[model samples]
Target: MNLFSDIRTLVIDNLNAMVAEGALPDGLGFDNVTVEPPRDPLHGDMATNAAMVLAKPSGKKPRDIAEALADKLAQDPRVSTAEVAGPGFLNLRLDTSVWQTLPSAILGAGASYGQSDMGAGKQVNVEYVSANPTGPLHVGHTRGAVFGDALASLLDYAGYDVTREYYINDGGAQVDVLARSVYLRYLEAHGQAVAFEDGTYPGDYLIPVGEALMAEVGDAYVDQPESVWLAEVRSFATDAMMQLIREDLALLGVEMDVFFSEKSLYGTGLIEAAIDSLRDKNLIYRGVLEPPKGKKPEDWEPREQTLFKSTAHGDDVDRPIMKSDGSWTYFAPDIAYHYDKVQRGYDLLIDVFGADHGGYVKRMKAAVSALSDGKTPLDIKLTQLVKLYKNGEPFKMSKRAGTFVTLRDVVDQVGPDVTRFVMLTRKNDAPLDFDFDKVLEQSKDNPVFYVQYANARVNSVLRKAREAGIDVDDATLASVDLSGMTHDTELAVARKLAEWPRLIQIAARTNEPHRVAFYLYELASDLHTLWNRGNDVPELRFLQEGNTAASQAKIALARAVSVVISSGLGILGVTPVEEMR
Candidate 1:
């Protein structure tokens, strides 16, 4: 149960009662009313802006309304004190029993404690890690992959029907370049020395693909013309590269529900259909474009071309859909791809791209808006660069990837759990520094290890209780009498646990999964704070000697923290370790 929501409903009901008693005017909209933790905890447990939001509309003084509302609120058993703060802010102190019941509620819900129905089962298509299928995924792609996968999982927990998708960039000219590069490898496999000249891939990852091609058709395409082998090799090379990409994703626990091929949009009526849909709306036109702002008239090349009126749908300017050579521009296939997504009946679309793709956000949003007539909402998240370091110095690049570090390079060094958690330690748009030495350090400064250590501590508590012959299973602890759990430090941790469900809704609404990692760190801090206090105060310890009831009451709180941490880490796609090694 969400304690914050429960208290908000309590506040609203008291306001309604005040209206009925003629203490305030009728028909005041309570939509703007909010109940949240006070800015200063010294003021109260929770604060509400009910009087301030209702004053102007009701034609009453905020203080007068707050006084009347406070009286009605005081009648509730959950609220212990309702005091009017500066300018009619109502600060509330809840009864100890309210926070005391939270541990039981958390244990009862288990891992589903923070799951929300905020999305209401709306279908959401999340497209991420759509890197070119030319080689294994690099470190840049890993950030998008982790962010998108975690977002999909987060939305699912918030009750959205999420589809994890990857749009393959296999239909572009890059695939032709990949085919030529593999052809050179094929020659090398045939005992011929070859040079990887300009504009060709020389990574050793393609060596096996070249050998496989030779084995499939022995000496058939040997020394053949470009036309004879380009198409066949392009198809084969992309398939092999996609296999490599899939294996790389698996290393990080990511699996897509769909792998959409951009090639399918060509040689078919799909592109024409998408463009025609725009044409029917008068958004397509043949017009001359203006020169760029900084370009001189003499240096400009302006021509009449087929353009999409993207400006009408919030883009900066109209974009050309066809080039002067009469071939589709790069943006044409993208429009068709998103149009196909809209046609699939998804209510929402989310694209995760590297920071380099920030310029494409507005145009892609405009395309989806025009295609769906503003019926579908699209959100594009750009993951910024990750700077790698070891021992406080820049890390070395992967020899296998040729130019950059591969996803496997990071995962192999720290395992998937550390890599995933550290990637999300910063906001998606903010640059992240992934320090190898610091992340693995078993200290409070390392959030991943600190959070994992909290869970491990809870497990240790349960094991010790079980060995002491005290029943510490979830059901038994959930039913334990927690009236003795009224200490200030114990209640502090409970207050953090109560914020879980609310935090889930906020993060899901804003499409920010990084907030989950942030919340877990705070919760872990609260837990560790209480755990440390036990050393000084004998009764504060979770395992009370010779008293089963008291020990169960205290251990229940530790178990509750573990439950919430597990739930949060599950959304982040990180497995919570039972014990930190």
Candidate 2:
């Protein structure tokens, strides 16, 4: 199904044959041999670097090896022709049947066409959207949430046993601040004036929590001291905040398999266990006497602290696990969390963090590395900021969130499909610009609409066919004679369809869901180009008057393109609209 990978195998087979014939050495390493789509479509269906990579090792010229490899490759029924081009690269043109067969494969596979086993069932723990449970998820958290959810889905499709997780920050001092804030709301609920102090949350979100607290306890804690009410209110307030975070995530169709509480690590001896595991490995130490590189001499001070030997695993410096006050640092529980994931017997770990947490990546990786003894690999992806715009001007704030734009604010206005697709229009590490006007615009410049339009156009064709009493279902068209689709423009679209499985693996392996967005756009472009061509060339149209046979084949190709688009969009959590309305 993967044409590029198949062709690479073909190239390797021919190289082995050449070695048997004594034209090349038997032991030449073929690891670097690669077959891929050439930069330009005009070059060939596929291109291989077999000659160049093996020339020096084989003690033979690249052009000489390429010519021999070309002849053997041409013997395969799938490869129609092979030619040696500049620098002895082999370009191959696959037979028309290869392109024609793709539509049938797509129809038969349906939505599972691009699903791959690239991860090989590796247990991958993807911890993401671990935002503080202080408030509802905002636009900043939305990007990470969407990116993480789509990643878990993508890895699942790629055959990874993925666990979508959220780490709650309830054990921190912030929760105490939240409790005090909600206590103010409780006092106000009792008809007493309350002023939010400097460290208390002032958002209206906590107002309801205050009222709920009053309803639950009546007047019991009306004038209670901080010790009598802080713990109870903090627990209640944290749970309520977590509920709000869950609702915000649900708005974007995100579901987590686990909601890990950082507070659990404190009383469970898990933090001590994780730190002790590192201590046993000689990674824990009471050290750290150097000042920061650029710190002023007056400001710099030497302080001995409990540290993890993160430098042993490539961190810039050792990381502190505990302060002089003996309380665990923020990074302490994080280590325990990942250690718990490692002990869960996962083969891989992936963390989806905000760009602000880029500094934590190295130490986290170091922790996972030491915990798993390098048996498990950890991949950390940082999602950058998403700048919002409206009518070409920067959108500054959200009324509901009281600070940043809430996730619901974006989803409510644009729906989940647009929000998901537009969020993945750029690389995760790169800044994304969410233009409210452009995403909804029904123009080629808007990728989301363009892709949906392609699917809608396919439906339009099927609607017309069904209305004309023609069988337009996939089963009927899949078995139709596709000889009429031999035109250059028609076959070009099929070529793009052939790349779906290969593209999926690449995107999934790189953990880059944005690649699916790019592929969908390109596939949509090819589809639209073919559709536009029908206006000028009457015979290229999908509707063939009085010729159902030819119409079925052509329509099959069009439908197959839409199927791939829908499948790709599904991977990115996008929905294909039936119509532009």
Task: Report the C-alpha lDDT of model 2 over 181-227, residue by residue, as the tens digit.
Answer: 89999999999998877977888888899999999998888889999
Per-residue alpha-carbon lDDT of candidate 1 for residues 484-528, written as tens digits (9 for 90 to 100): 998999999999999999999889999999999999999999999
Listed per candidate, the RMSD to the true structure in angstroms reads 1.3, 1.3
Error of 2 at 69 (Å): 0.8
Q: Which residue pairs show backbone clashes in model 1?
A: none
Global Cα lDDT for candidate 2 = 0.89
- Clash pairs, candidate 2, are none
Worst 10-residue lDDT window for candidate 2 reads 396-405
Displacement of residue 211 (Cα, Å) in model 2 is 0.9
- Give Cα distance to truth, residue 256, candidate 2, Å: 0.7
**Model 1 spans with C-alpha error above 4 angstroms:** 22-26
